[model samples]
Target chain A: MRTEKIETDVLIIGGGTAGCYAALTLASEAGGKRILIAEKANIRRSGCLAAGVNALNAYIIKGRTPQDYVEYAKKDAENIVREDLLLTMSEGLNRVTARLEELGLVILKNENGEYAARGNRNIKINGENIKPLLADAVRKCDNVQILNHVNMTDLLLADGRVCGAVGFHVDDSTVYEIHAGAVLCATGGAAGLYRPNNPGFSRHKMWYPPFNTGAGYAMGIQAGAEMTTFEMRFIALRCKDTIAPTGTIAQGVGAKQVNVFGQNYEKNYGITTSQRVYGTVEENRAGRGPCYLHTEGITGEQDKELLKAYLNMAPSQTLKWIEEEKNPSQKDVEIEGTEPYIVGGHTASGYWIDRERRTTLPGLYAAGDVAGGCPQKYVTGALVEGELAAKAIQKDLKESGADQGRYFAGQTAGNQAAAAIRGIYSHHLKKEPGPYSIDQVEEAMQKVMDQYAGGIGSGYRYNEKQLDLADEKITLLQKLAMDLKAEDMDDLLHIYEIKERLIVCRSLIAHLKARKETRWHSFGEHSDYPGKNKKYEKFVNSVLKDGRIQIIYRTLQKGDIEI
Target chain B: MSIRINKEKCVACGKCREVCPGNLIKIGVDKKAQIRHPKECWGCTSCVKECSVNAIEFFLGADIGGAGSWMLTKEEGDIRHWIIHKSDGSVKTIQINKKNSNQY
Candidate 1:
């Protein structure tokens, strides 16, 4: 394989929502600075917005204040949040929404010329091409370079600071050693960790992007970056087989959650996000299942609206309706909870970053879903975090007087990292096929997580004994993963993806065992503890030291708590 | 559900290959796009929208309530049509304007 070295002032990984926006912000604020975005897939249609979205889910409406949004998210997450991060992110929500509008996003406006509000904290938008718009803007910047089809494997560190990263092109034998003054990781969150609702050929049919295999989280964990709240997983309550979002019906048409007997049960448990999924699971366990969003008897106009709204984000649901020759007015939409995912956007489970978005490692900053402490940070919130991270990187680069020249001086460390990655890739290429294939090992890992680590098969519940088994089985899979072989660049990518998932699984199980309380119901249902404890209100943080997950607990940061 | 690419409709534009999130679609020696890993395909239909010639068709498998229907996309100026061919010799089309997508 050929090796290529790249030097930049700032390197942004995973050119999705946050990475593209961060590139735009950095290019606009600091011209002539070299900025590079390394994306595993093309930026035009990647990450969670590949198919697009129906609305800017996180926005400050006309009546609601930023503090009000923070309070809402804090309440939804049951007070285990970084209020400072949420407040900072909340304050910039509207600004980024307006920026998106200026950049050619179609935000719906009401008769008063105000942006249409979906709920208290969301604005309606035709966001099918949101990623393309952001990508187009970034492409126009002369100082930015986009490296598409490059899968980042690991971070490059000098001493204790993150100097750059190393990755390989997905379609070729070219390895890239990217060195930068500061690195901003926006790789999004992890999916496919647990066995999804659909199996076999439809395995990718889940809530989050199946391609986002928690590379950032795995790399950070390997580098010993502090991570928080991995136990607070995000389980989306979606339409039954299609796995399309239910929010379009619930919020757009005001549909209520009802059981098989058409009994409203959303309030029976709670209305919080986690509580919504928890109630669904509980109802199903109590044999009142086959839950649904009561969409029957809706007007034809509303049915048309729901169909078009789904086309903007998930067209499968719309297609399912069309194929069945049925509309929401005719039947209620069946809904179920997806396998749990570790995402910081909907639920906080990612890097433990400070207010400025700096991780524990120097020169390393995380934003978007990869950055923890902020839940419900949807499209607009990711954009805000990108902007926040860009501003912070610019300030840090200026204050530290670290330029491309000084960054290039760390080529020795970069060479060592590049060599280590090249060796790993070479080993994979040269190794003979072992007893387990990539799919076999991946399926085993998923089965272990599904049965023993609170996956949907277990109704999202687990005890200390189950977690211990999960830990043991996952460790064995990691060892088997080393003996796996790669046939081509495609196989190499799959191998790394599975490996990254295993690493995240290891850390997730550790966090699950550490958090003994059943604080968030189905999200973190520690059946051994069975009850929430005031003593366990602190954040459960972990850092990998000496090849072991070192658990650390820190008190909550309640910033400007006027609620 | 996976995708099937019709070589006759493919113009070898390479757009489908670039947009596939899984990188499952590749242009073969005949300069026609093909899905290398059909089983691994997530049926996201990103390639369908990017294909200007409607070369890629997503299978609506029976698992997800579809009775072996196939879906394709056709773009006409600012309007995009999602056409589905049902197994029972029926066709259904949904037209969406790119600009007025949020008119609701």
Candidate 2:
């Protein structure tokens, strides 16, 4: 295997939505600084925006203020959010949306030439090429270099400060040792950790991108960075088999959530996001086997609008509709809650960062879905976080002065970290076939999580006994993961993806046990504690210390506090 | 449903192989793109969109409302033309201009 060394002023991992924007911001503002983006796939179609989206879901429409957006997010999360992060993120939503428009994105405009508002906090857009546009803009920057098809395994740290990261090329055997003065992780969030809605051949058909395996969360957990709210997972309420976004049909045609009996049961539960999913589960349990978005009486024009909207974002849903020859006007779309996912963009579940997007570890920053405490940070919100982190990195690097000399001096440490990862790769390559294949191990992990950790199979509810069993089974899986062998580079990538998912699973189980209340309904339903407890209102944080997850509770940060 | 690559139309540009998120597509010894694992494909159509020559076609299985229909793409400048071939011998086309995608 070949080894390559790289040095950059700022290293941005996972060149998806946030990573691309962060690089664009740094390249423009931090003049002459070297910026490198290492992505698992090509940046033009990476992260959550790979297929594209139909609307900007976090904008402050007319008559709505940034503070109002903050309040909406706070109420949705049940007062367990970082108001500072939400406020800062909310304040930049329109700015970033406007920036995207300037970059050639097509935002739908009304007859008055203003942006066509979808709802109180969203505007429609034709964003199928959003990722490509961002990638194109970043490619124009002279100092930015993108490493496509590189899978980052671990972050390089010295004296508890991040110096760089280590990974290998997916198609080849080249190991990359990158040493940067500062690093920003925008790797998105974890999917496929729990059992998915579809099985076998169709397993990858889910709400979030199936490729996002929680690498950022895994690396940070291994490096002992504090994480928050793994228990408050994000369970998307989507179209039944296609798993497409229901927002288009709901907001576009003003469809109401109705059970099979044609009765509206949405308001019976609360109107919060979690409550919606929880209500569906309850309806099904109460003999209403199938719940749906009532679109029976919509006009043909509205049906065409729904089809066009989904085609711009999720083509599979549009294709399904076309194949069935039944439009929304004739058939109501069946809805179901997908498997729980650990995503900070939709729900707070990632690194505990301050307002400037700095994690507890120095020189290590996080943004986008990987940065916790800012929920409901849809596409525009992620762009805002990326900008915020880039600005912070510029200021911090300036204050610390040019540290190339010190960074180079840390080569010894970098070598040691690289050697450790190399050892694992070589060990896996040379090992005999174990009892279980990587696929088997991954399926086993998912089964354990589904049955015990509030996954879809268990109606998104878990008790202490189930969690204890989950912890024990997951620990055994981690041990088995170490012994699993890889036959080639492709197998190697699968091994690491499963390993990262396992690590996130361990952290998620601990957080689930630590928070002893059913705070967010089906998101984190604690069967043992069926009701929310005032004592458990604070954030449930954790850090891996001495090979064990240590739980820590932090008081809520309210209002727009200065850093 | 998974994607099937037509070797006759393939130029081996490797665009589809590079853009596949699952890394399921690879160039064979004959220098033609082949899917490594058809069952594992999620049918994202990223590869289909990237294949400029229409070498790749996504199979529309009977499971998700599609009964033996196939889909392909043809990009002409900024316009993307999505063509569908049905089992009943009928064809349907949807043309979308990348620049005016929001006009609807």
lDDT of 2 by residue, A302-324 (tens): 87767766767777787787777
Q: Candidate 2: deviation at residue A472, Å? A: 0.7
lDDT of residue A501 for candidate 1: 96
What digit string (tens of lDDT, one per residue) describes model 1 on residues A338-428? Answer: 9999998888899988788889899999999999989999988998899999999999998888853557684687678779989999999
Q: A112, model 1: CA deviation in Å?
A: 1.3
How displaced is residue A197 in candidate 2, in Å? Answer: 0.6
Give candidate 2 regions above 4 Å deviation.
Answer: A403-406, A559-563, B60-63, B101-104
The TM-score values for the models, in the order shown, are 0.98, 0.98
| lDDT of model 1 at position A17 | 90
